[model samples]
Target chain A: MIHQTSLMAIAIFLFFASTVIGISFYLGRKAKSASGYFAAGGGIHWAVNGVAFAGDYLSAASFLGICGMIAFFGYDGFLYSIGYLAGWIVALFIIAEPLKRMGRFTFADALDSKFNSRGIKLAAAISTLVVSCFYLIPQMVGAGALVQPLLGFPHYVGVIIVGLIVTLIVTTAGMVSTTWVQFIKGGLLVILCTIITIMLLVRGISTAPTDANGKASYIAKRGVTTVELQSMGTVVEPDGAWIGKKDPVTGDMKPAPYVRIKNAAGVVSVWRKDVVKFKDGNPDVTTFSETQATYTVNGKKNVNGLPRGKGEGEADLKPVGYLSKLPNGEKETGSQTPWGFLSTMQKSEAILWANEKIKDAAGVETTVYYQKPTLGSDFMTPGSSPTFKKVREEKFFGKLDFLSLMLALFCGTASLPHILIRYYTVKDQASARKSTVVGIGVIGLFYVLTLFLGLGAMTSGALDVSDSNMSAPLLARSMSEFLFAVISAVAFTTVLGTVSGLIMAASGAVAHDLASNVFKFKLDDFQKVKVAKMAAVCVGILAIGLGILFSKMNVNFLVGWAFNIAASANLPALVMLLFWKRTTKQGITAAITVGMISSLAWILLSAQAYKDVYGWDPATAIVPFSQPAIVTIPLGFLVLVLVSLFTPKPKDLAAVEKAS
Target chain B: MAGLDFKGSGEREKEDAGVVAHNTKLGVWLFLVYVLVYGGFIALAAFRPDVMKQPLILGINVAVVYGFTLIVSALAIALVYMKTCRK
Candidate 1:
């Protein structure tokens, strides 16, 4: 109800983001030399780089997406934390030293090491731009989301302001400012999150969470229409006519009852009462009366638009726990352990809190059923990642979807060009390795704390179910206004850290690789740096626009697309070039191109895309409904194998330069 | 100059050397490689949990199995690389 915290949070976050921008501008003059700008003269300590790794790695997806997931779904959200931290191993053991031992500024530099093909430079640069831009979208959107509750600013304003600020951070100092900003953000983010988690443990779980209205707000989704009560609950109709239920035997009009909230004691009750729906233009100002009775679930029935054809193992989407169960007769654990009461359904299956009146096939008024997530398995269940929707309504399939998402997250990390570039910022392979270890510790700690933060939010009564993104900040709001302001501000910077790093990588690719080598521009080192700054501005704008466009998509899900693209396009070519000597420029080129294109096409044509982006019927999407990794990663390897065999090996680097 | 031979070929070397004053770019690429591999493992932790889950230490999922294995293995790789690449 208050936009009070928003101003303070915005002011504080702006102060932080802008100060970094000023520092970058001051330090960035030195970065005008290609070596300095690209790698910070390769003198950064592994410790600093290590924390910077956390800054770059902990994107909007990690903060908002993971917190939102944990808040809404129990234990399932922590799975993301574990998955994200695991990807560092691939970078540490498999790719680290050899990659350092290989090439220069871009992933293309390492990739084009042997062949010196312009094709390699061109392709890798393009892939870097695409993946970096994709990743930037979520960061920008996350910035906007945090700003809304924190600063009370409009969504696009948050997006635009963050974009401009990041552009300033990048164009001024390039990697120098980018690194320090991330360094500060990374350190602050983890420490603050750790504090929040501790507070959550101390607070424990509260059975009675007071609302602003001082009355329990009962909400029900009736078909397409939603009825929410300020005090109890309100019901409205589609054609503007309120619907009332008739007594089955008495043939008399009876009002639907909301939960007979008994809050005199500290714990609340979930008893049902009846009231007739009466309308006078504004249906909200109406009265309710008790039903003077209680009803049990005679038989369970499916209520959604589900056409009941599948069996239990096939489609038994059951609820997890009762919102209100009676004492003695009802099995009660701690009122807040979401998983313990998950298996049993409550005695009262349906609580008819409110309904919406809609036109039926005959064009007459009809009422659609309104119910909560059932107690058995349906409540606290995972929803589809756009028809990547596995059997989440069931147990095993839900776990598998969780598995699939984590799989992408882990593999996606090492493959990212921006993160890979950080390895080069530190001196020597040893620093690279040690820096990573520190990064793991920092990132791992933050992830573990996310579980507490999420669970805290889930039980925090402050959650707005309509927007899962609000889980963390809203949870903070329940604790204290000041904590909410700080956490919300930190979350906005979290977007700032990742997006700036991503833009830096994309800019370098365009200026350093695409313009200089591929197009053969004979520019001075200073000119190269100038081009990079311009590229940062361009990439920053694109990121902001896409962030606003995809404002509504879940931050976590949007990141999955970035991961899928990075793993497909970048990893295959990189792995082959390092391990297999037979790899020609043709093969590596084909693999990278194929991996990037195929994965992008699959995700774009994906059923999830059909549902989310194109608004098509999900069932119409024909791919085997799976992560493209199992197919695309290997395809990249295979294309490299086949193309390398078929095409003539390009001239060796020594001979080519001699010829030139 | 003696150890790196700044201008000399290794046991086998390519002749296209544009030797700058420092080894800045090579270091950056190596860092990039580390970042990618690190990212890959993070993805694995997310995607494949059991592989990373070592015994819980003080109720904390330290990712000990993954963490220890990574440190040890990275050390081993660095050792082998230094040994083989010595001039």
Candidate 2:
């Protein structure tokens, strides 16, 4: 896909990125001390911190991935929004005030607050690094993904660019700049998305060019028509369609088109295949391509990539929202109320796009999109995704997978190193609680807007079926180029805000939690800040490297794994320390170590990993399901409890005593 | 402990401690409610997707209504937590 660089998008993205860097340098003076660098001098207003919390929490996964999921899959995508927002309740009610009161810089501070144990510090610092790195991969991946469209840069170049920019932001002012950056980005995201949702509502549902009886109308052709051509091997028909090349071995004409394909290893190959019909009786058609012969004006084809309406593409993608029937038996319900829109859509026809990998006559594999007209209610229901289908089947492992993922999402927010650190940004426990409430409100509202943004994009005819992450941005572009530029720029900032926070957490874990506290490095405040800056640079480079490596995975799916790890590693100890009087430092250490290792191993060995990362049969995986939180979270709590019961009591018991 | 009392007022410490205890009890109770509601919703989604697809008052299904309700309830509970716990 050769992306055309839009000057408007470049200008807007540059403006936002530069403004963020300027703010960082301006705030650099305040970050001279370790305390200031790690915790923003603990003086931010609760309200601003609250919005910043939203900003930090709403990463590329939330904005790009979830919207893309909803655009492609329907209600399944919005499930992520609900699960994410619900996590804030844990942050607010369980962790917020306690974390604010106990911790100074990192999540380790809270655990080690009672005993000041080096073992506890070491375990927690490792856990923090693991979780932060896991989370960082998706953010960096999203950054790379954004650059392809916004800057017309290659994926690795985008990763490097984001890494450099984020490192600059973090090394300059640390939390002060990070917090302010999040605040602005969060506010803009929610406001702009809300405006987009309103625009979608006003535009409402209309007849697509395909739906209307026009030159490009496919309304008459419902199911795919099977066409067989004469066995013309290696022949280009007068109609411009390529035919199968002759097999060298058999000297027989085979109906397979030969095309060159580049694999992940960057090796180009011409793969060979012969057509074979499946038992289902469907023809083994490699791909479907209908040339826009009628789209020519004055012997010139229409401008490529100028959207469906004006381009050589099949139909004009108009505002398509509400339909009257399940599939095209139409009484058109035009514009509707928010409630009306959803209700009408439930009974309407939704033209969803699906893709399948096809091997041409040459073994070269490519994905092609085909329209699948489905009932709106069916599209809006669960089980549309292959991941969630087992739940609907009432399968035990499938249900467990669903439950574990949800549990991780519900528990992960409070445990995330970056989010826990935000509690320290506010002045006091009261401010922490207040900010949490505000964060929940802001984040919740934005999640609601995602439902509209996604569904609007679904029928907006602007979907790039090949890359689901670009759904929301393409939806914006369909409206106007200017809006698309602004949306893309803000989405890029979304990546920057999140990656910066993760780097900050990783750096704090290394320098403050590990070096100064755990290893007893006798570093002064200035030296600590210096060490942290160096750590940030290392972590930033590592994130960029991993981002490029995991370029194929969806950001939302990657975030789910991050949540599972965070919940498994951190939640049990934090909850136990605060609520249970008997929680020992040894227990916290053991729990963190065991929980982190177990969850990480479980994910690496899970079925999804076997299929996606390792390219093996999922059935051969050791774990029954992919998500690890259901098993690991309980294991964490059990380890903490049993260890505490067996271990000697802490000499100080300050945390328990204070609670009593 | 000494560093914790930043304001250096004994009365303030006592009041702060009292607030913490009060907030803890309320927070725990509220969290239980949230878990029950949210957990129940997830259970329904997993076991009975068909039930979730059933239309509620509007043509809107049970899933959308419940999801929106959860969002609204989170905001409402947050406000309630702040209101009752505030000094």
Candidate 3:
């Protein structure tokens, strides 16, 4: 299945990639100067630019993460969609025209427009590069991830393919091709996803997901002690790194680093074997003597404790957290009201709502849990995007989570440099304003639909609780193969469109500012094109490498980090440049630099990084969490204020007149 | 709205406010209208969380019932523009 889909996905994507490359080439002939390439000579239609905003903004994280989240976590995923769309309110009212009126080609162009400080140029350029790259990594990872099931190729292949295709698209024409590509993709994705959702509602849940034997195309598996995990014809590590062979067939040479897990239970065991093409290649099934087992297996209990073996959301299968046959010591009447079950959880002192399991160094486990959310609705609780993360999940959360989520969405939208530069492509400030509204309309509708889609997936019995990213495509598969193919392809294109825009932004920053402004490398218009293309190639390669390395992280979680960085680093500087009359070169420069550096520093030292990357006993990070907007937004404003006060106004006052 | 940028800065300066800036003023109002629509929902959540539990006119809560009121405001703004545009 993986190989066939992977090949088909690759073939279609290549065809799409080539067609875009052709468009870029055709557009390039008309592009003469830096402005032509960077801003499409400021001549794109407003409607097209608006749709392009959807394309650029809806990254792999949006499609994969939201859908998967909805499938697994329910209403939590839909909340993300609301938060994301709410942000454009800021974009439409606050920053739209001011942005178009202020800048020439790039996001940095707007920030550096008021004061031609090399420092502002340097800082804004670095921030753009950093944010773009952070955003790019998730798309790259999604690229690799999507290729595995669709094209049947490895994740690395998918990453390389996207990197190459995006590089070709950007180098060919720059903003013109990128904009049109986004417009086409954005329009198609929203329409098609809506169509898919309608179909799902028409065909409601069934006991047999696809076939009657209760067999799923995908299922989760626990530890594999008896069976060997091999890669490249050799015994492999968890990461698929090749180790020396193990003769599990022979009793002698067992696989190195392989653990032994024994379970003694009368119940039948179901193991999801990749059967290849998935993690740990399928669990190698072996019958062992019951004596070595650590778990005594206190009978059978499902995630929600009902029947032993069946897909979730099946009619015969009980709803999760509602017991047909309760666990030992658990009591419930079948006739209980919904509110009774939920309200009891709210009052219970036993922590269930916000539970954390912590293990000390001596190998003792201590659990600290909250008991508020009883998973009554299951549709409206934590565990994914489009939903409020900390606030909706737990009670008594400080307003910090509420503010952080809103602030991330609000500032993240405008601060995204890819979304910003779209304004420069339109003819004027009015077009910028019009396009933003159009984008709001399109993006808003799609976000509302995500709730239905997420609900449909949850009920469809395709929600992989461990991995939410697979929710949408897997949900599509539950309905039909054709829908799965279409959804997967659109999801693939989602990554492609976003990564292309990001790479273009990064390339522009490197070529336009770092080369021309920082090093003072004087390149003619034609030479500038060449330099930008080279820069695209370099950034593309970097994104490809990072994407594969960080493939394990959820796309939306990574995207949240991107939002925090973009909001903290870029937003305050841009807002100050437009609104504040006293905004000096030093202020803009220092704000961008300090905001970027401090946020980046906080993320690296975060608890998430310690757990996921460092694999060490988690350290207490300086910031309350990795998200920096709560701290960094105010800091950027302060830096701008203090620096502007001390520094002299630039000799060039023309920027103030023209910018307005 | 589409080709306004082609007009020279001098042409723009010479032109009267003549419903263009009137529309611009309308735009400012419409933008504020949008803010109210979204902000109103949050306010309802904060101040009248219980109102969401009760039906307003229909079986829907006051929050759910008024959710479309915000979008309707956006439509009202859109319609106002359409009414005044050059035929």
Candidate 4:
């Protein structure tokens, strides 16, 4: 959807961005030491660190992607909310305290503290880089997505801007600035989302929602002028309708049975196609159908034709998603409670959007997005979307895919390098524990609000069917222009907070784990900090390039892959090291290597990747299911146990026993 | 070994060791309880979707109710752990 640039949005965005950059510059002095640069000098108050955890963890994917999914597919998106929040349980209960007690700088520090093995350092560092990079792609992509509608900039410009700002944030003050940025953004995101949810509940559900122009949101059918057909030959083009296809067997062009109307401004808009009838002795009659225009021509690059986006000489894609019928035939329900909202939605008929691809004889493809009036109960179930529809299938592999994703989400949080690094920023194990509780509370509240925000967008009559990620912001726009500006600005910071944290982890791995530990460099505190800042610059550049390159890809699934890899690779090593005394350095190294490679390989070879990323036939994918944690996580544990059984005890074990 | 001892040398280390062991034991038990609850949710969504679609409380179906419960339970358990565990 082409959004007119709003000065309000630009002003609000600049205000937030400048404030964040100001915080980074102010904190630059505190990060002169290695500990300060890497771990905020272990002095972040538990409360601030706790909100920052929410800020760091709630990336663009959480705010934009999940809400968009729920806006389009209802409860399936909420399934992600449930899975994601559950992972914090593992983080708080198992990983938080011990990790803080064990690690000094990075996740690798925690793993290598047991054996101080170079092999362990190398493997863990590589895993950290890989997971961080996988996680970075989606964030960069989301940055671009936001920039387009919010700032009226192209995708790459947004990617570069975020990349540069985050690099500056990380290079200047590292974790200190990163934590403060996250705290501010996280607090704002939760508070603003709560306000939006309250607004939506107060307004309640409406069957016929009007747009900014006071135009009725519903699209009605129109009758077209009759035209004569002559042996499937070329016919004179109609004044308003365009040819959608040529008869496949014949060379004759067929005008798609839709009518176009031009307003006083000469803006041409196409209405939905309904019926095309041919009488033996008379001209053919065509009638256009409901509110949405089904067929959209893929015009020349950046110059879309009528009824797609508001390009030159093109009509705007009508804002979609509203209730076609309310419960008991009521047109609107005003001022509902939270539970009352869900209960009302469970019975109403919502007009959702679905699209299909078709090709003309000229081989130009057109996407036909049409309205689908779905029962609230049906969409409110787990299998409303294609991604999770497998859960409704009888095939074991289908169900297993859903189960594996949940497992990855459950175990993935504690293993994420960025999340693990946050544990070290707090003062002690007690602080770490308290902050996690605080983190869970803040994050949990946001996830709950996402349900309302998404559902509210679904009925807001301002949905962009093509971009689900825009739903939350568009929902905000439906409420008020000021709210839209605030929500978009907050979301932009969401990307910044997450990207800074990931870069911090990546740079720490490169400097502390790879350069200092693995390569046996005798670096002082200043040198370590310098090397890490340089690494931050390099990683920031790489992230910007990847973000731009993968701009066209759907980024929601990449996050799932990150979780799978993080869980499969890091969890077993961290868990065994803390729990099992016999876990040798060789075991930790082997587990990290095997778990990372296997999950990565499985993801690359999985059906979802084949279809979505590689654009290949999914049937030929090697893996039975896309998510690898169900298999690779167990493989990690098994590899560690087997490798440890064969390796000799570390020399430090005897010394430690004697000392004890 | 009942607990892996990776702490540095000191009286503070010994004191933390006991607390860490106590917390780990309690954590593992709470973690298992959550796993059972979460596992039930995934299982029901996958196998018995019909049951998930049935109205459970008020007019909301089992899926929304169960999903909300899962999210609430995580925070609840975390708060429980924070209150009850040795800090």
Best by lDDT: 4
Candidate 4 docking band: acceptable
RMSD (Cα, Å) for all candidates, in order, is: 12.2, 7.8, 11.7, 6.4
For residues A118-198, could you state the per-residue lDDT of candidate 1 as single tens digits?
999999999999999888887888888777757877899999999998898888777777888899899989988887766
Please, what are the lDDT tens digits per residue for candidate 4 over residues A1-660? 678787888898889889988878877865788888898888788898899999999999999999999999999999999999999999988888878777799999888876778999999999999999999999999999899989999999999999999999999999988988899899999999999999899888888886645566754323433331222123333432245556766968776654445444543344455455566767655544344433434444321134444545555566788887788899889899999999999999888887655454555554556666799989999999989998988888788888899999999999999999998888777789899999999999999999999999999889987889999999988878899989988999899999999999999999999999999899999999999999999999999999999998777898999999999999999889888888999999999999999999999999888998889989889998899999999999999999999999766666854664
Docking class for model 2 is acceptable
lDDT of 1 at A57: 94
How does the DockQ of candidate 1 come out? 0.07
* Pairs with steric clashes in candidate 2: A256-A361, A271-A362, A271-A363, A272-A363
Say which prediction, candidate 2 or candidate 4, comes out ahead on TM-score.
4
lDDT string for model 2 (A303-363, tens) is 1212224334323322222232432464444666888778767777766655544443444
Worst 10 residues of 3 chain B by lDDT: B4-13
Q: Model 3: which docking level applies? A: incorrect
Candidate 1 docking class = incorrect
Point out where model 3 deviates above 4 Å: A1-11, A205-378, A381-399, A649-660, B1-87
Candidate 4 C-alpha error for residue A303, in Å: 9.8
TM-score to true structure, per model:
0.71, 0.85, 0.74, 0.89
Residue range with the least summed lDDT across 10 consecutive positions in model 2 chain A? A230-239
Native-contact recovery for every candidate? Answer: 0.02, 0.52, 0.03, 0.64
Window of ten residues with lowest summed lDDT in model 1 chain A = A313-322
lDDT, candidate 2, at A294: 14
Number of clashes in model 4?
A: 1
